[model samples]
Target: GFQFQMGDGGAFEMMGGGPRRKKPKFPKGVPKDIAKSMNWLKGTEWNWNSWRNVKFDKDGTFDAPTHDCQGGFCRWSASPEGKVYILWGDAGLHELQVQGAMPKEQDQAKMQGLRMKGRRTSDGERCQATFQRVFDFEAAELERDLYGILGLPDDAEEADIKKVYRKLSIKYHPDKNP
Candidate 1:
């Protein structure tokens, strides 16, 4: 059966586009500030009822670790090839984890400026999480080495790697006052 009315005495037969898609983008020349404002407007006033349509706040980030620990399953995880993505919150930083997709160097850089989308869990309750959390430089270096998990070459021997690791550790160690 088709929905006969939109509550405004308007025929609501044949629902519009399917509820799932790549999600819509703002029209051309629409400033981001305006688009965000418009989104807020539609949400706050029109009661577009997106809560029933999409998940809670369709445009939120998914932090798997935070979510898993906090019991919030609305964490988004997307991977293409060896590249993994962990979108944080709408305003939080997006952590891009690139592994050894390339055999050269397993570089891990954290950029703090990116927008994220909302995530949905098995339950209906919604939670918002931000991605940005300042980390000490030493922690970052360890994370960088952990990337790709490929490890250094076997022929290089453990001594070489240890030397490099020590150098990095000294440079970023918090007590070093770097």
Candidate 2:
């Protein structure tokens, strides 16, 4: 029998001991600058479209599905376009699905299920990649809060913001001001 040994900083070689716990995932496509600064894995880097989506709190931690806690084959978003990812089991992150040039209709047929479910890195961590879109919510800058998140120009009139906010709010908001 070959006994496993921990050699030289343990840089993630799969020759360990006892059943080989799957390795955690590293994010991809995130700019090195941003990654180094935030310490998060780019949500857009993984393929979670076919995999069920996962959600996270503003703090970058994984939340329960529909807020549920029983983790499984669930992922965060769809394709490379969406953000956030939570995979079930100890999958090699690289094995996870991705947005390739293949046609949408034929995707399921290509499933070998040989994938990696890279666990999500929190939204704010040093040497990590973050989804800027989510961070925008917590942003405090007036210009960013108003224009960047709200989708308005800084020069837009108050009336415009209110009107748009009111209309958009009705659909998503909890109030019945209408």
Candidate 3:
């Protein structure tokens, strides 16, 4: 049997005359820095023009809720050169070329303020998307009381929000509730 390993510890074993590759050990999900840079994409609701609202997890999973694809089964990965790839199961794969001024030594505050524009190519069709990091206080106020519903403080961290959401989801799931 022959075995091969990547620099990142991804291993391939020879089994039955074929190579069976093991999952990569590092960077299972989007890198923290990349996820943080894309946080502005949160809270966007689905529209006719877009497929769904994007949700990213630190564990490399994502959810874009829609009639077509639901739950956190989707996954995303990025390369060192700033290319983001999304494996949206059934919905198809999407490749995004993220363009922004991301400095290596900047603080989170500066990173949060970074706006980006990207060209997305999916299923042979191309489209352009722009991301703005600005917050609209008035619009947020007008939006439903998500914090209240989630039983979290307005200033809760993203991780806290996701934790609470998962807890509530399991608690109120139709199968469990019913």
Candidate 4:
């Protein structure tokens, strides 16, 4: 017969010597930052709602949610005790454990700069120049293709490029050409 215990210790024993603890499983759509914080909060009182309130205020304060809320979550601020906190429902408060500052890598910085420049430049000539500069910057990053060296489209796939290279190689072979 199966045994069933009945006290606090019994509950642990019934569930194989401890509380029935399963790993926390966040939804697929949860952002990495929120997920990170939530994972850290597992076993504590905090839950998904706590993750939702987290924000990374660039200026050390919370940004308005109505604005361009990048990273798919409202920004947050750090309390005097150095813990991350968010204001909820106009008056409610929630403490969040953010992993790090808002992600502002080099690429993000470039895009931010470009957006600021775009906002400032209203003249058609300036806009055209800006677009051209952006195009040149992006194009410079691409590897020059071997086909492009032979005046073929860079989009030519490996097989096509190889085929063209073989044809050219055979045509230029000295024994066959002379």
**Top candidate when judged by lDDT against the true structure:** 3
Q: Worst lDDT window (10 residues) for model 3?
A: 40-49
Q: Compose the digit string of candidate 1's lDDT tens values, residues 2-65.
A: 7665466444645665453232232333222212211211111111113311121223222232
Ranking by TM-score: 3, 1, 2, 4
Whole-model lDDT, model 4: 0.34
Model 4 spans with C-alpha error above 4 angstroms: 1-145
lDDT of each residue in 19-69, candidate 4, tens digit only: 533322222332223222222111111123222222232232333344333
- TM-score of each model, in listed order: 0.24, 0.22, 0.39, 0.19
- Residue range 27-137, candidate 3, lDDT tens digits: 334442334344333332212124433544444555566533445556665555656566666555566665576434323355443433333344466643343232332
Better TM-score candidate (3, 4): 3
Q: What is the lDDT of residue 165 in candidate 4?
A: 86
Deviation in Å, model 4, residue 94 alpha carbon: 52
**How badly does each model clash, as a count of residue pairs?**
5, 16, 1, 4
| Local lDDT at 119 for model 4 | 13
User: Comparing 2 and 3 by TM-score, which wins?
Assistant: 3
TM-score for predicted model 1 compared with the true structure: 0.24
